[model samples]
Target: MLNLNDLRFFVQAVDCGGFTAAGRRLGAPKTTVSKRVAELETALGARLIHRTSRSFTLTEVGRDFYDHARAALIEAETAEAMVRRRQAEPSGTLRLTASVPTAQLYLADHLPALAEAYPKLHLVVEVTDRFVDLVQEGFDIALRSHFAPLPDSQLLQRPLAREDIVLIAAPAYLEKHGTPQWPQDLAVHAGLLTGPGATTWRLGGGDADEAVEVTPRPRMLADESVVLLKAAAAGLGITCLPEAMCRDELARGAVVRVLPGWTAGSVTTTLLMPHRRGQLPAVRAVVDFLCARLAR
Candidate 1:
């Protein structure tokens, strides 16, 4: 007796922010979409949304029902996908997030192939430095780079890469300031530091690789590491950067390594997903694609 089509209309209406928008997306008339959602409300015997002349708001019960409704739709889609996947390619919109630097330096390069391989698949990427609640925010996946192990969470964590951090400065910068020969030599030099800023920078030294922490006087600071990369390349100051990102620059002599024996830091990039949603074909393809590409 449950009308899943009506349920779809209701969910799409909420997602699109209005029945008219949902109808546009669904290739149906606005009146039809609105009526379908109304029939769904009648079946449930609850006022799911409060409609206004220019807008609509989900009722308290509607908010809770919307969450369940989305999950049910996903389940239904997954069941059909299980059959189609054997003969067809994955196709759907996948919403994902990544830090600013990761998006620029890493993910942007890897995504093109996903598009090329799955022409029907659509990707929505959010480039941000802040951690987002995957379920609450409706993101399919998140790529994060962190120093410490991820905190306790229900989200499934997949380790991607542990990249070494290196010290880099433009040839012009060293020409002006002179090259630093030792870890302590960095004290007098300018630093293009990343945020949340580090009070003291830790450097590795000696054959046994002992740790040395130095307080950097920042010439410039930014929340994103890519910003510092630009600043460093412009001869603004020295900064810590992932070695993998420095490959092309290091090869072309655009930037030179400082204090060869010492390292600035390291980072681990991880993929996070909400529960069983990772099993969906489109989501799984992205996960697999990123894992394989980022590994290189």
Candidate 2:
């Protein structure tokens, strides 16, 4: 087999004009450099150079080989430098997947700061409700929101935050239907629900907990929390959504929280990554950024 190192030496010898000069440039003995080139030629069964006492010249094959060898060496060096730079600083494309609501409500807003901090990092975000196979799908990280602890999986999960689910309704809806004083009052009002457990709202904080199963008379049934939020704000019905998702509307008084002292449930926001040794700096940077920002 032709040794890449030997090819490198041959290219350096050609570029430096002679074996002695190439040896000095490479910090190797002239005889050692000459011997490696001879081995490379022997491996390829071709005479790559013609030598004299004073100087060396390339054979017809040597000229063609030198051009290719020099280009290869340049490419190899460039690749090494790029990897080293990436190791030292976060620089590369990071692929992330998250639910549409989490992506739109949380990650979408915070990604700009991450980009600003790591200017060399490129982001490819995939937003979908479907659970993706990280290894098969080639995702670097995944952000998920779950009411229940995630089941066992090969992917590593880091809990980012426990987000409260607040019940909200448009002022018009609240005024016309009359505000619900208790969890049971939600049954008579139009309900905008999300996911399979839409009709089942487990409310309250401590021992005062109450489980209210409203009839599935949903005005809107969707997987995305944003859709449910918009429906609630449009006076379609009251819906329970992540507080983070409805913070703006709640502050603007576009939508008011129903049952102020109660919450439906809290979902744990988690960061998921494939288990691997030595995570890339870009991936580590994003993870740390999220943990810092979202944990607040």
Candidate 3:
């Protein structure tokens, strides 16, 4: 059980040739330096120094210990420097988790720029619809979109974007089933839904908010928004999705917004991290990147 500090003190004393000299160099008392070396000797159960009033000498054991101690101190210092450098610069692997749709549609496109900007950083992204425990899963960060305020948790969250949810369907589906002139007309149409929001479509903005109960049941049900979106794109049914996720599809006429004037509601996109303190440089960099770009 060698104390690293004691080893450092012993090495310094040996290098300086006396406790008094080592103390001056270390900004410590001479007696303190001598005591540390003594404690180090006691811990090793070996006398490391031969002392006289005139000068201090190293025993054979002391010389051997000095060599190893000096090398250890150098290695320890090198490791410290390396970590400090990493802290100053964004480098190393950043583990992030996000919903499948957001990852595929939004994050995928932005990753290239992030890579180019921080060449030292390597990103490992996990895409899943299920909420993951950031601490338990060892994730550096998580990107999540929620309509409601997130449940109380120890993790810190930063709002990245307020994403609007829009109902969309393929042109063929709209044409065959006939377009819904009002939100209630969605009850008769084949609805592609993800999870609990399957039958309940909340529309409008501000004080004019309205809830339309969908009927005839959902034609397709899936846990992933992307799956429901693909089903809607294939002309199976109408589905609601994030505007950002469907931007490309909408632009290319793959999917058209249903009930254009209405919305399912806006969800807050957030960046979740374990704590504000001691965040790795890479994690901080990615968080900043997403917040800046996504907000735009």
Total clashing residue pairs per candidate? Answer: 0, 0, 0
**Which regions of candidate 3 deviate over 4 angstroms?**
1-88, 195-197, 205-209, 276-279
lDDT of 3 by residue, 229-283 (tens): 7898999988888898888899999999988888888878788887632255566
- Lowest lDDT 10-mer window, candidate 1? 192-201
On the 0 to 100 scale, the lDDT of residue 186 in model 2 is 75
User: Which residue runs does candidate 1 get wrong by more than 4 Å?
Assistant: 12-34, 46-64, 124-139, 147-154, 175-178, 195-199, 204-211, 222-227
Question: Which structure is stronger by TM-score: 1 or 2?
Answer: 1
**Tens digit per residue, CA lDDT, model 2, 15-108:** 7788998898789999999999999999999999999997689999999998788667656655664686656767767899998877886698
Of the pair 1 and 2, which is ahead by lDDT? Answer: 1
Candidate lDDT (C-alpha), each:
0.85, 0.81, 0.81
Off by over 4 Å in 2: 1-88, 195-197, 206-210
Tell me, by lDDT, which candidate is best.
1
Q: How many residue pairs clash in model 2?
A: 0
Identify the candidate with maximal TM-score. Answer: 1
Ranking by TM-score: 1, 2, 3
lDDT of 1 at 249: 82
Candidate 1 lDDT at 256 equals: 86
